[model samples]
Target: MSGAQRETTEYAVPAGVLGLKGPVEKPAPGTLPLRGDLAHIALAGSHLAAHYVIPHVRTVGTEGAGLRLAPRADGEIFATLPAGSRFELLDVAGEWVWGCPGPQGPTGWCRASDLASAES
Candidate 1:
């Protein structure tokens, strides 16, 4: 998506609760399987996502995988998923898959090659 479109698609965390002023704090970037436009269905009511999804569960490969902040090799690695770890798969782009280790997560990008179907 274009930069402008991306900006427009982002969902802001809601401000205030019980008459407060500041925005409702969101969890750390990789700690919730939520982007401005999409979130895990389980987060409904707690977050606003343009669309909510039910993730497809996958398993980390024997070599394991690093969850990166961005969908590039050079992206920062925030979490290291051990082999056989369960991954909640959300979106995929090229060789990268965007997802979390679970509903409560350190969500980020992982190489598609690093994951296998649950049965694998």
Candidate 2:
């Protein structure tokens, strides 16, 4: 091995455990959290899990900010966020960003331009 260190995590369930809702996660760039059905999963060469993301919350910038099921204008609109509304930003793809209304609230994609950093 080179001077760089590689950390490997083990995922083994205890004996007699059953009825797991999701699969165990492999190493990821960030931490994985498990809640209901939402997950920050990537499958290039590993698996991942999901959970409530109350820490990475962001603000809805300007008026007419919309939270949609997909990251497109034609995506279904679930809610119209007011200026300064806070939501947990989950992922990003091009001009779109995935997020939820709150830690345990509904999740969807929103236009990245409509979102502002919470500290901004």
Candidate 3:
């Protein structure tokens, strides 16, 4: 077989933090899988995180608020940021929404400019 046929695609981290432990969820509607780096922001009263989407963990933002962050792997709640939490936008869709990873095993949709890095 040709090298192309034998070769497989290496699933890069979906635009977010790293070393996080969670489950992987289905991408949003009309959205496709992204490679490396996502985007997020912090709530009105919350703290930010270092990385974006964690590897193998799922995240989900709150409902209606347009915020979600799920882990890529399945496990206990390794970490949490609670509502009004802070996050960085590793990926942005248009100028409205951002796809980010949250605490262990929790991925969902979120606002575009609602998250911020802990450094910021």
Query: Each model's TM-score?
Result: 0.77, 0.53, 0.27
The prediction achieving the highest TM-score against the true structure is 1
Model 2, C-alpha of 105: deviation from truth (Å)? 1.4
| lDDT per residue (tens digit) for residues 1-120 in model 2 | 557654432222333343444666443222232224444321212333343222466778876477776577887786677888875676778999876655334556778888775463
Poorest stretch of ten by lDDT in candidate 2: 40-49
Instruction: For candidate 3, report its TM-score.
Output: 0.27
How well is each residue in 22-96 modelled by candidate 3, as lDDT tens digits?
545534432332333432222101222443342332223342234333322232333344445444334445544
- Give the distance in Å from residue 83's predicted Cα in candidate 3 to where it truly belongs: 5.2
Tell me how many clashing residue pairs each candidate has. 1, 3, 67
Per-residue CA lDDT of model 1 for 31-82, tens digit only, reads 8999998998667657666898878888999999999989999988888999
| Alpha-carbon runs more than 4 Å astray in model 1 | 1-23, 117-120
Candidate 2: the clashing residue pairs are: 33-50, 33-51, 39-50
Which is superior by TM-score, 1 or 3? 1
Off by over 4 Å in 3: 1-64, 68-83, 101-105, 116-120
- Model 2 regions more than 4 Å off: 1-55, 117-120
lDDT head-to-head 1 vs 3, winner? 1
C-alpha lDDT of all candidate models, in order:
0.81, 0.55, 0.35
